[model samples]
Target: MDDNLKKLIPFALKYKPNIIWNVVFNVLYALFSSLGFVMIIPVMNVLFGEEEKVTKLPTYNGIWELKTYLNDTLYYYVNYLTEQKGAAYALYLIISIIIIIFLLKNLFGFLGLQHLMKLKTGVLRDFREKMYAKIVDLPVSYYSEKRKGDVMARILGDVNEVQNSFFAVLELIVKEPLTIIITLGIMFSISWKLTLFVFIFIPISGLIISKIGKSLKSQSARAQQENGYMISVVEETLTGLKVVKGYNAETYFKNLFTASVNRLYILTNKIGKKHNLASPMSEFLGIATIAVLLIYGGTLVLQDGSLSGGAFIGYIGMAYNILTPAKAISKASYQVKNGSAAAERVFEIIETPNVIRDTEKSIAINSFNDKIQLKNITFSYDGEQNVLKNFSLDIPKGKTVALVGQSGSGKSTIANLLMRFYDVENGTITLNGTNIKDIQLFALREQLGLVTQDSIMFNGSIADNVRIGKLNATDEDVIAALKIANAYEFVQHLPDGINTNIGDGGGKLSGGQKQRISIARAVLKNPPIMVLDEATSALDTESERLVQDALEKMMQNRTSVVIAHRLSTIQKADVIVVMNRGEIAEQGTHDELLAKNGTYAKLVSLQSFES
Candidate 1:
C-alpha cells in the first residue's frame, strides 16, 4: 500500500498473466508445505501407538464431514498395515508420503519463483524504457538546472536500488503471507485455542521489528542523495581532468570527493545496522513463542489428557514452520522501506515537466521562405536578468548576416532562440511570416542547420557521425559533404576512409579536424538556413584558415546567421551587426562600419591592437 509500490502498478499490470501464474504456484507451494508438516502426525502415530486402532474401513462422507472422513481413512490403513505386515511397514509408508509432499512443495516453490522472475524483470525493463524516454525528451534547460551525474544516478543506481530493495522483496511479499496463512490454518484445525496464542505472538513480533526500521527510509534517502553528489564529483573530475591537472587542483577535488563518500559511508552503515536487526529479532521472538507453546501443549497432553502426543507434537512442528515466513516478511518490511526511498528518486526524473515542447495544434513546415524574423523579443535564462531585451533581427533568404559581440553580449542566445532551444519570455520568431511557436518543434528544427564552437561527436565511425545530419544519406553523399567542408582529403587518408572510428567525443582528432567533420554534417543536412556560433575561434592559424574556408563554402546560397568573436571571419558577410549589452550597437557592411568608427570599428581596432 506504499505510494512508491504503486508507481510500479502501470508496469506491473502489463504482466498480469505472470502475476496470476505466480499466485497459483505460490498457493500450491503454501498448501503442500503445510501439508508436509501435517504428515508428522501419521509418522508419530506409527512410531508411538498414540492413535486408536481401527478394525473396519471408514465410511464415505459429504464435503462437510470430509475432515473426519479423511482422518479415519488414514488411521484405518495404518492399523491394517501394522497388523498384516509390521509397525515398520506403516512407518515406511508415512515417511514416503512426507517425502512426496515435501517434493511437491519444493517443485511448486520453484515454479512460483520462475514466474516471479518474468514479472520482476519485465516491470524493470518497461520502467527503465519509460525512464530513458523521459530523459531524452527533457529540454536542454532542465540539464542546465541539474547535474549530469545526479540524473545518471536516478537512471542507473536508484533504479537498481528499486530492483534490489523493492522488487527483491516482492517474492517474500507474495509467498510468505500465503505460507503463514496455510500453516496457521492447519494449526487451528488441530487446536484453535493454541492457534489463538500464536496469533498474539506474530503481530507483537511484527510490531517490534517495525519499530527498528522506521527511520530506514529517511536514512536510505540521504544515502542515495549523497551518492548522486559523489557521482557528480567523479564525472566533473573526468570531464575536466585537463583543466584540473593544468590548475594543479587534484588534491582539492580529491578531498572534496573524499568528504562526499564519507557522508555516504556513514549513512550506509546506519541503514545496514538497522536492517540487520530485523532477522535476529524476529527469530528470537519465534523461539520465545515456541517455548511458551512447549509448556502449554505439554500440559494438555500429559496433565489433562485432552490432546494426543502425536497431535501435540505435530502442532509444535507447525508452529516452528511459521518461523521462516515470519522472518522473511519482517525483513522484507525493512527492504520495502529502504527501496521506497530509491523509488521516489527515480520517479522524480520520470515526472519532471518538459516545458520546451511543441504547442497543441502546432503546424509543421517543410521549407523556409522569405526570411526568418525575431520581432520585439525579450528573454532571460534566469527570471531576474534579461539576456536580450526588445531585440529584433531579420535574416533574409540567401543572405549571410553576422553578429559580432564580446562575451555576454547575447550573440549565442540569439542563435538558441532561433533554434527554439529556449522559448523567449516575450517575443515572436517567425519563419515566412508564420510564428515559429506555432510550428511543430521537430519541423522548425529540421529546417535549420547548426554548427557550434564545440564539435560534439559520438564514439562511432566517421561515416556514422556524418549520417546523423541526414540518416538516409549514402556513402557518396557523405563524401561530397566532407569535400565541401574541406575534410574529405583527411578522410581519404584514414585506413578505413569514412568508416574510421572516432574515439569518445572525437578525442582521436584535433580540434580543427573535429570542427570540419561537424561542418560536413551540417552540409549534409543542406537546410535553407545555417547558424554558425563562433565555429573558428578555438583553432590554430592554419586550422582556422581551413575551417574558415569550409564555413564560407557551406554558407554559399544559404541564409546564414553567424555569431562570431573573430572579425576576420565576417568581413565578407552581406550585413554585419555589432551587439553590446543585448542590443545592436551598429549594423552595416564591414567598410561602412569602419567609416562610422563606433562599436564595430572599435572592436576591429582592438583585434588589430592584439594582432
Candidate 2:
C-alpha cells in the first residue's frame, strides 16, 4: 500500500492547485457547519428563558478576548431587540441568523465537492494517457505472456476504481478529520468532561473498523483480478467468434465466461458484507456514547445545577454531529484499502520497465545506405530452442529478396527480428554496417514499411486510415498512394469516397479490399525498405492478382523482403532462400533453384502440382 501511494504522488503534485482548493474549502465548510450547530445555543437560551440580560453592548476586543466579547455581544443585541421590537420579532431575528449560517455551511460544502471532482477526474485522465503510452512502447513479446483483456480491464475498469477509492483517501485526509476536529472543539468548549468520555469509545470502534478494512483489501483485490479474467474471456470470444461458431463451440465459451463471473460474484458478496459492517457498527457505537453521556450529564444538571438545560442539549447536538463524520472516516478506511489494491494493479503496468528501450548512448539512423544484415543469428521466442539458428541474410538497397518455406521455418521470424520486435539471443543484425541495437528504435522503424496478412485496420474514415502512414499527409498524397496500391477506384465508388467510414477492424470491406488499403498505407509511408509478410496469401485468386500487382509497384526501387507461401508471387525475386528447421536449405533465383533441384525446386514443383 505504501508503495502504491508513492505512485500517486506525482499525479497529486500535478494538480496541487485543486488540492489546495479542496483543503481550503473543506476547512471553511467544517468551520461553518460547526458554527451552525453552535448558533443553536443562543436560540435555545432565548426560547427556554435562560437568556442572560445585558444593559449595554460589549466593546471590541483583541483576538484573545474575542470569545467572551462575542458571547456578551449577542446577549446585548437580543436585549436591545427585545426593547425596540417585540420578543416575537427578537425570536424571529435569531431564527433568521441560524438559517443564514446553515446556508453558508452548505454553500462551502458544495464548493469543496467541486474541487474534489476536479482532482478525481484529472488524476484519471493523467493515468489513462500514461497507460496508453506505456502499452504502445512495451515489447511485442510482453503481450505473448499477457492477456489483452486483462490490460484493458486495468486501463478502464481498474483505473476507475482507483479514481473512486483514491478520492476516499483524499476525503479521509482532509474533509472528515477537519469536520471531526471542528465538531469536537465545540463539544470540548461546552463540557470537557463529556468530551473526554466520548473520546474513549472512539478508539474501540476504530480498532474494529480497521480490522474489517484489512479483510476488505484482500477480497477487493481478488474481485478485481476476477473481473479482468472475465473481461479477457469476453474479448477472446468476440475476436474468435467466427471460429467458435464454425466449430459449434459457443457452449464451451459460455461455460468459461460463466465460471469467471461466478467466482467474482461469490468474492464480491463477501466483500459487500465486510464493507457494509462499518456503517452500522460505527452508528451503534455513536448511539452508545450518547446514551452514556445522557446519564452522566443529566446527573450534573439535576443534582448539582452545574450545567444548564439548553447548553446541555446543545452539547448533545455537537456530540451527535461527530457521528456522521466518524462513520465516513470508517467507510473511507475500507475504501482506501480497496483502492490501494487497485492502485497497485494500475501502477504495475505503469511502472513496468520496457525491455526494448533506446539507451542513452544509442544513435539515430535516418536512411538505408547499404544493406540490412543478419549475421549468423541465433534467436528464440522461448529459451528452449532457436527459431533461427546460425542463419544469415543480407537485403541490399533497391533489391528484392524472398524467403519461402513451410510454416515455422523462420520466415516470419526474420521479419520479427529485423523489426526488433524481439532481439536476437545470439549474433547481430545490422543496418548500413551499424548494429541495430545501437540505433534508436524509432529511427530504425521509421525507415521501413510493413504490410502483413492480417491487414489490421481501425474504425475510422478511409483517409484517416491511409493518413496513419504519414500523419501530415494531404488529400492529394493519400489519393496518389491509394492509386499506387490500386485502391483509389474502389474508394472513389464508395458513398463518401475517401471519407467513407470503415467499420470496426475494416469489417465493412472484403479481405482483399482491406489488404489493398493496408498496402496504400504502406505506399504513403514510402520507406526505403519494405516488408511484405504473406501480404496476398489470404486473398482470392482475382484479389491476389490485383494485390500482387500493387505489391510489385510498392517493391520497385525499394529494399524488399518478401515472405510468401505462393510460388508464383516471388518468381521474379533477385534471390530466393529456402528455410527448413531453423536453417537455410537452398539459395538462388527462382529458375536457378529450379535448375539446382534443391528444397526450393521441390517446393516449386509441389506448388505446380497443386495448381
Candidate 3:
C-alpha cells in the first residue's frame, strides 16, 4: 500500500462494522452469481437429453463423495419427473431455480453497494470536517500567503475526488476481487486446464493496467492544481469586480481566466485519456483470453472428450463472468491512483503543525488586570525585513493609547501581537504580568474586542451579528449594546429592526451603519481591552462623527489601543504614541506632543491641512 492509503486507514477503520457487512454481502453475492452460472449445466443436459437414466435413487454418502451423490440424486429426480409427469415440468423447475439464484445474487449486490455508500459518505463528511477545523485553527498569517479560492478548492473539490477514488478502492479491494475469486473457483471445478490458461493472461492484463494507473496519479495531481488556480481566478474576479470594471481591465482578467481554464482543459484531457484507457485495455485482453479458451476447450471436447459439452459451455459462462470484475478492477486502479493524489493534498493540510498553539503549561486568563505590555518585540510577517524592530509599548488598564503613524509603520502589528494573531520573534507581550504566549489563546482573546476599518459582517440578522461577540446575549442585551454604540435608532428603522438580514458584509447598510454595528458587537462583548484599527478612517464627515462618538463611548474606562490614520480621531486620547519606520519616535498627551514639534505634530498638521 502507498503511504497515502496508509494514512486513510483510520478513517476507513471508523466504518469497520459497515465494511465487514459489505464483505459478507459481497461473498454471498459471488456465491449466488457462481451458482446461477452453474445451473446452466443442468439446463443444457436436459435440453440434449444427456442426463443419465436412473434405475434407483442414490443412497446417502460420506462427505468425500457428497459432490457425486448430490449430482446423481438431482439427475435421478429429473429423470423420474420426466417419465411420470413431463420434460416440460422438469425444464420449468430448473429455469425457476436459476431465476431465484439470480435474484438473490442481485439482491446481495445491492446490499453490498448500500454499505459502501454509507462508508463513502461518512468518510467524506469526516474528512471535510477535519480539513475545515484545521483551516480555522491555523494562524492568520497562513492565509496571507494563500489564495482564498485555492483553499476553497482543496476543501471542496479535492475532498470530492478523494471520496470517489476511495470508494473505487473499496470496490477493487473487496467486491471485485471476491467476485473474480468465486467465479474462478467455479471455473476450476469445471476444468482446471482452461482456468490455468486464463491465469496466464491475467498477469499480462494486470501489467498493462498497472502501467495505465501509474501516469494517472501525476496527471490527476496536475489537474487538481490547475483547478485550484482556475477557481482562484474566478474568486479574484468576483472580489475585485468594481476595480475590474472601473479600470477597464475586464479583457485582461478575462484573458487570464481563459488561459488558466485552457491549461486545465488540456491537463484533464490527458488525464481522461489515460484513465479511460484502463477499461478498454482490460476488456480487450479478457476477450483475447476467451478466444484462446475457445480453441483449447473446443479441441478438448471434440477430440479427447475429457470435458462434456454442457460443462464446457458452463465453463465459458464462468470465464466470461471474470471479464466484468477484471474491467472493474482495471477502472478501480485508475481511481485509486487519482484518489491517492487527492489524499496527499488533503492529508498535507490535516497533518500541518499549527505554528501558533497554546502549550501544555499555558495559563488561563479569567479577567484583564493591570495592563498589556509589549516589551522589546521584534517580528515580521515573512522571515526577512522586520515589520516591528525592537518595538516596545505599554498600555495601562482603563487608559486610551492611540498609535499614529503612516501606513506600514507597525501600528496594527502591535494590536495583532497583543491578540496573539501572530507570535513575536523576540521578547514577550504580557497581559497582567503573564506572557500572552503562556496564556491560553482563546482565554486571552476573550478578554479583548476588535473593530477594524472594514466592518466584517456575516450574512445574518443584525442581532445575530452582534451576538457573535457574546453567543448567549439576550435581545435586551443587544438593544442596550446598540444604544451604547448609537446604532439603535438606525437599526430600529430597518424593515425587521435587529432581525433584518444584512446582505453579504452588510452591503444593505451605509458605511457608518456597518461601523456602528461593529462597535455594538464590541460593546456587547464588554471586554476589558479593545483594539480599534482606524475605526472611522473610511467614513465621510457625518459617518465619522457618529462612529467616533460610538468609539468614544465604547472606549470609556476600557484599556484600549487605537491605531488612527486621521489624527482628529485621537486628539483626546490619554496618551498618543507616534511611530516612525517600525520604531516609536515620541509619546505624550496630544497637547503635550504638540509642544515637542516632532513627528506627532507634523502628522497632525498634515491631517488638519488635508481635512
Summing lDDT over every window of 10 consecutive residues in candidate 2, give the lowest-scoring window.
602-611
**What are the root-mean-square deviations of the candidates from the true structure over C-alphas?**
1.8, 1.9, 1.8
lDDT, candidates in the order shown: 0.88, 0.88, 0.88
- Report the C-alpha lDDT of model 3 over 434-502, residue by residue, as the tens digit: 998888999999999998888898899999999998999999999999998888988999899999999
Pull out the clashing pairs in model 2.
Answer: none
Segments of candidate 3 deviating more than 4 angstroms: 52-66, 609-611
Which residue pairs in candidate 3 collide? none
- State the TM-score for model 2: 0.96
Question: What is candidate 3's CA lDDT for residue 253?
Answer: 96
lDDT of 2 by residue, 1-611 (tens): 35686578788788899899989999988898788788788778778877778878888879888777888898888888877996778889988998998898889889989988988888889989988999999999999999999999999998888888878878888888898898887788778888998889889989988877777878888998999999999999988888999999999999999999999999998988988898999999999999999999998778877777877888888888889999999988887877888888888888888878899988998789899999999988989888889998888999999999999999999988888899898899999999999999999999889988789999999999999999999999999999988889899999999999999889899988898899999999999999999988778888788878988878888899999999899988999989998999989897788888778878878877332
- Candidate 3 has a TM-score of 0.97
